[model samples]
Target chain A: MTVPDPRFSLNQWTTRHWPIPDLVSGCVARGVRGVGLWREPVAEYGLARTAKLMGDEGLTVTSLCRGGFFQEKDAIAENRRAIEEAAELGTPVLVLVSGGLPEGSRDIDAARARVAECLAELAPYAGSHNVQLAIEPLHPMYASDRCVVSTLGQALDLAAPHPPEQVGVVIDTYHLWWDTAAYDDIARAGAEDRLAVFQVADWVTPLPEGVLTGRGMLGDGCVELRRFREAVEATGYTGPIEVEIFNEELWAMPGPDALTLTLDRFAEHVV
Target chain B: MTVPDPRFSLNQWTTRHWPIPDLVSGCVARGVRGVGLWREPVAEYGLARTAKLMGDEGLTVTSLCRGGFFQEKDAIAENRRAIEEAAELGTPVLVLVSGGLPEGSRDIDAARARVAECLAELAPYAGSHNVQLAIEPLHPMYASDRCVVSTLGQALDLAAPHPPEQVGVVIDTYHLWWDTAAYDDIARAGAEDRLAVFQVADWVTPLPEGVLTGRGMLGDGCVELRRFREAVEATGYTGPIEVEIFNEELWAMPGPDALTLTLDRFAEHVV
Candidate 1:
């Protein structure tokens, strides 16, 4: 029988309250197929230790939480380190959060130029490792202090000069659901086989913490999850739509409770 | 002598600390000739009352702050009323802050479509009154709650099917500055004669209210005002580069004092 809706994967960030191994185990107990993890936790658990845990617990990593920030005057050394980490995790796609405007700089175009240059320099390193870079266009609020890549189309353009298999985009419904060209961008990425990862989250009300705390739990906000999912699926991306909400309230809840809610919401609203 | 920076104007929301009349007198007092004003104070002062005040004070009403909540069911009626007020104010442009995702609705595309349809319907009404409808692409932070139009490129596309003279964009630095395509959009807007209003404000720390406090006090934030002015001017539309800041702290300050500071920055950084 065809799966009811699509399978739901959980990013540890949504349940940041739990330990990484516990998050892995908790996800498995709840019938979650995959987990998106961060480098620091993996490093803390030791990549070998975490990979072992994921294997024993039978958890599939949807994608790595991120690897980007290719800015600054000399960023080669930093990017190389990130690449090595992604390779160690053995995740299929390494999510890359393109960083924001540098402090004391006013020219975003110049800053974006720096990102493009960094990507070109790091492309060979990323290529050598068999790691794919997924450029996640963050919310525009973070545009000043976070990622400068703000749209899927812009991300596609940045990826154009590089090999699509090497560099692609991560479509988090939270970051891109509001964009006018979101559907078109996803279709184009899928057409080119550069639709690297599918991330799920919601844009919340009252927009807490201004920048970070405001991301809603999937069902809490108004993003059309089914529409967003359909758009990605239409792009021929058969990958899992990972739930990656960055919420404080959800974090305070018990990990299993959050996981249960996430799964339920995924089935009810998204799937 | 050629004006050093002829495109500069003042958006009163920047120095929101000041009363509208004080902002008007201050704009003239400080050699800043154009102004973008919100409706609340105009309503408080009465539109006819404020219009003659602007004329008497020799201030150019660059654009009225807004005239679109185009997503609501009654958006046509709402916008018609807004157009009447904008025309009454004698501002050549009526800035439209597209309302956010309709609460409880998961469909962003549908909301965006509604906004577009509203614009299409209002375009004629605005044209008849000689009020150019300026679609202000709000910061993406507001995508779910406020303006769904979140990029200059998106706004341009929304305005594309309409005549540039009748429909255009409000290139507010606070909103469009974070967009990766801001520069290209600015240049493109100018090329198409759709640069309706060039607003200035600093992207400050998100305030306690969870909104971008409109806190950029001219030189206070990282917006490249000079370069932005240069880019807009290059567009061949020598319209007012209005300083439109929405800072609460600035609003708390005495309006005249805020005006004084706004003018000083306009001369130093903008002009």
Candidate 2:
């Protein structure tokens, strides 16, 4: 049997319904060596137990799913806890989905400023935990509700003030593929040593209602996945390429079947 | 009765079902001095008849809705005819929604280049007709299917090659309000004399399926409508401000009532 690509990391959300033990064993069975863990699932499974299980199975915790929803009142304290969790899990990266506008707020600039401020507040704590904060810019469609950071350049700008080891930006193909400046920003991210986690997902059309779960599977949509992978690699990024699709159909499939499909597509289209 | 804001123009698609004759008379009755026309409705109403009706009613045609699906085989010829129609209707701007990536094609760069090539072919014809081909950069969400030009800066870049009077850019607030560089691009457009048309539609969340007809009514969402207006005016743009919403609920209203609400919203939230 062919071993899975060494760089292939399954983001937990890809097989969201899979029980923790089943997901770990399924990844092991498939020879997938890396997994990005979401905070909720890790917490639900008992963080220490999840960490011990991955460690025992010789799997690397590639990154913790997220830590930045600065729009919330308790965001800083919550992110502090998230940083500690990442440290306990032995992951080097913590992804940040900066929350969008405050309730009924038309002031995007203020919201963005708040993200920068929150990063400054949390960077030291994250750095002390040896976890790099990876700011993930969502697609512009989610600019109002999900994430205010809507471009890689904007993410880089937000990360500029922080130490590269403490705060960096995520280059998710699904979000940045539409940006004309993405390639340049990728090169910039590398030059500045700010490239953190690289996530893969495809862009599909006629986006579903609420526009959140309609992410296309790798190789299924028009996104130049291989090209994006090469671009990130060309920027000296040798990090695990996390498959983070959010398609409902894919999620409906049994976890192992979905993993097999994703592995095949990732090999065919991304790597 | 108070006259509608003199700069206000109702894009016909905002009242998609309003009959042309009724729409014309309704605008006249409501003191709306300007209206933007769409190609299909104008063709159905007879382009010459629509022109004559608007002229006879002393109403200005703010713009001809669009003319730039360069992905189509016969785009140049179609746009040439659109230019002639815009000339006949006495409108100075022809809004161009540069078509999306061709069927199953991922070469956005090539699609964008096609827009430039088509512009080169149509600019002279449009210039001779006293009409500017206004490339309207859609929101990034529409980048794949509706228009490849997805940022005001990119629209300005595309317009840079042609004479400002012959080729320009459309600043639709609904498409550009999320862009951080939109304000700067507006200033650049003004400096370059490339601001041809200004349109408005608010953006509400929970985007419906397809995401096309989900534009919010003015003042109903988070857009800073009046601020966007000030930014345009600050750039010396004194042209018509077209209200071009596409909400299903708005379309279901009586045309007159919709017009009244829009005018009221414009006065309260946009002017």
Candidate 3:
């Protein structure tokens, strides 16, 4: 039997229903050497305990799921805590989903400005913790209520004001596939050494109401997933390739079943 | 009683159920000087009759909704018929929704290439009719199932190889507001004289299933409608500003009432 690629990381969200301890064992059983974790589950499981559990299982925490939401109140403090969490977890990267426009606010420019301000404050704290802030530009559909940073180019621009070691950008196929400039931006990200994390998901259509939780399982939709992995690899990013999907049906399955299906898809479509 | 701006053209789809004659008379009564039309309604009313009615009502046809589903089997022949219809209606702009990937296809790059080929075939026919082929890039969310052309930059790039008089791009705020490069692309469109038509519609979240028909009435969402208008005008584009909305609630209302509400919203938030 072929061993799973060591670079393959199952983002905790892919098996969102899986408890931390089970997730660790499941990854080990399936030969998934790394994982991209979310803060909520880690805190719920006790961050230190979760860290020890992963260490015991020889599982590397690839990156923390998120830390931005700058439009929220006390964003800097919140992100600082996130950086500390990444440090404690021994993850080298923290994903940032920069929040959207403030409620009832039409000025996206102002909201984007606030993100920069929050990042400026948190970058130093993140650097001290040795955690690189990875700006993940959510698809443009989420620009209003999720993240105003809607393009990989914009994410790279946001990270420009910070040290490359302290700040970087994420390359997610589901979000960036539709962008015509994605290839050029990917090259730019690589050349600048800002390609921190790589993610894969396909783009399925007739997006459900709210358009969240409708992400496609790899190979079940239209995204060119392997191409994105190759692009990031071209950038010398010999790091984790996280399968981050947010499908409702995927969550309804038993955690082990879901991970099994995801690993199969990841091997077939992504790696 | 404030006068309606002469540049405000009520697009037929904004009041989708309104008959052609009723739409023309309603615009005339409201002091609206222009009307943007769709091909289906024009055909249903008889193209000659619709044209004569608009002429009798002194309502200019600002543009014809579309002429480009390039992925369809009969796309070229069908687009030729559309160009003929636009010429018959005396409209100078033929909006092109270049269509999505061929069914079950994942190669967006190839789909985009097909759009260019179709444009090359249609540009001269459209030019002969004195109708500009205006490529309208729908928001990226529609990239998979609606239009592969998902950005103003890509639209402009597609239009670049053609004569400015023959091929141009549409600036629709509803489809473009989330883009960070929108302003720059708008300026580029104007500089190249490829700014053929300007459209407005607010974007409301909780996108309905299918993610279409969820467009907001102006001022009812987060888009900066006036800013988009100003950006287009800044490009020396003095053409009619088409109010093109596709909301189920707006479509369900009485045509005259919807038109009245649209005029009010336009004056308050978009002028």
lDDT values, one for every candidate: 0.79, 0.94, 0.92
Stretches off by above 4 angstroms in model 2 are: none
lDDT of 3 by residue, B66-137 (tens): 888898999999999999999999999999999998988989999999999999999999999999999999
Best by TM-score: 2
lDDT tens readout by residue for model 2, A9-106: 99999999998999999999999999999999899999999999999999999999888879999999999999999999999999999998999899
Query: Stretches of candidate 1 above 4 Å error?
Result: A1-6, A72-74, B1-8, B206-209
TM-score of chain B of 2: 0.99
Q: Which clashing pairs does model 2 show? A: none
Q: What is the lDDT of candidate 2?
A: 0.94
TM-score of each: 0.92, 0.99, 0.98
Candidate order (DockQ)? 3, 2, 1
How well is each residue in A71-109 modelled by candidate 1, as lDDT tens digits?
A: 654567766777787777677778887787777777788
Interface RMSD of 3: 0.7
DockQ of 3: 0.89
In model 3, which regions exceed 4 Å deviation?
none
